[model samples]
Target: MLKLLALCLLTSLMYVQIAEAGIRYYKWEVKYEYKSPDCYKKLAITINGRTPGPTILAQKGDTVIVEVKNSLMLENLAIHWHGIRQIGSPWGDGTEGVTQCPIFPGDSFKYEFKVDN
Candidate 1:
């Protein structure tokens, strides 16, 4: 709670350029399905009906808006940007219990963050 507050304060005091460059919107559906990447069929999480998911195209300083819908009947969903920094939007950081909470089943969460260095 304190960390969230401090992050919010720092972002507000600093220059926030989210959406200053441009805004890119994307809608993704999260669900579980049967997939085989190594010739073995197993249950796997797929985004938009794909195992690896779709590619997100963006440049530096651009704001990415992704609305993710969790279709899993008995699971929670949280998207963590592997190497991207969560700038100006820490609530959407997607670190589960750390930065944000999990999106419950049949629920949705909109992640809005800027692509920073």
Candidate 2:
């Protein structure tokens, strides 16, 4: 029993240490712009003024910090991390009216979370 207990405690400490080891940060800006996706000019929601937004590249156990700014004149915005597991940071889920309020036009919000895959 004593040996098992010591092993369990050591395993838990190792897990915690590994989780806190590799963390990276990032920032992104969301903006509204006019673009021609199919040769037709139209207003589109974009990140950094580009359609389709920017792709985030991170390894497991990394941290990301995205600073989103709503530049639209009349629209509210929120961002969601589709496949990233936000384990302990539920408020950064970006589900407007659920996890957090919508970011109004001309306003900004910062999302900080660690990626756990």
Evaluated with TM-score, which candidate comes out highest?
A: 1
lDDT of 2 at 109: 88
Candidate 1 clash total?
0
Number of the predicted model whose lDDT against the real structure is largest: 1
Number of colliding residue pairs in each model = 0, 0
Could you give candidate 1's per-residue lDDT for residues 2-21 as a string of tens digits? Answer: 99999998897665554356
Candidate 2: segments with Cα more than 4 A from true spot: 1-23
Instruction: Write one digit per residue (lDDT tens) for candidate 2, span 1-117.
Output: 999999999999999978765655556566667899999999887788778987777666677778787887888888888887678888888888998799998898888888777
- Give the TM-score (vs. native) of candidate 2: 0.75
- TM-scores of all candidate predictions against the true structure: 0.77, 0.75
Q: Superposing all C-alpha atoms, what RMSD in Å does each candidate have to the true structure?
A: 11.9, 5.7
Candidate 2, clashing residue pairs? none
Q: Number of clashing pairs, model 2?
A: 0
Evaluated at residue 74, the lDDT of candidate 1 is 95
